[model samples]
Target: MHSIAFRLVAEEEEGRLMAQRVERRKLRDTINPFELPQSLFEKYYRLNKPGFQYLLDVLTANTEAPKKAFAISPIAKLSACLRFLAEGGYQTGVGKDCDVSNKESCM
Candidate 1:
C-alpha cells in the first residue's frame, strides 16, 4: 500500500517534469527570428520558414485568442504572398482560406 502511494507520487512528479520540458521547448521555439503562424505557414510557402514559425508560435502562445477575422499586418501578408509566388503556388488558396482580400498581383 505504501509502495503504491509512493509510485503515484513519483508518477505525478514525472508528469510535471515532462510538462516543464514541453513548455521550455515551446518557449525556445518561439524565440526564433522567423517564426510565422502555423495556420499560415503550413500552406507551403515557407521559405526561411523556421524563423517565421518560431515568431508565430511565440506570439500566438503568448496572446489571447483571436477573433475569426484575425488580420495579419500588411507587410506580413505581402511577404507571405511573395513566398507563395516564389514557390509556384497561388496565394489565392491561402487568401481564400484565411478570408483575406486577394492581392491583384497574386492571380
Candidate 2:
C-alpha cells in the first residue's frame, strides 16, 4: 500500500511538471513584438521603433473585427506581416516563425 501511494504521488508530480512545461512553451511561442527591444525589433521587422509603431497604429486603425471567435492581436499580426516581408519567406515559413497560421498570414 505504501509503495502504491508513493507511485501515485510520483505520477501526480510528473503530471504537474508536464503541465508547467507546456505552459512555458505556450508563452514562449507567442512572440510579443511590442515587448521586444528596439534593436531586435528592427532586426526582425526591418523597421525602426517609431516607424514600426506608426505602421502598427495604421494597421490597427484600419483593421476590421473578426466576425466570430477571438483573433490574434493586431500587433502580432502586423509583426508577422513585417517578418514575412523582411525575410522574404513563404507564407508557411513566416507563419511557423511567427507562430501564426498560413491562412492568417494570407489574410
TM per candidate: 0.31, 0.53
Give one digit per residue, the lDDT tens place, for model 2 in 13-103: 9999999987645644465676666776677788987898899778878878766554556776677778889888856544455433222
**Top lDDT: which candidate number?**
2
**Clashes by residue pair, model 2:** none
**lDDT of model 1, residue 80:** 55
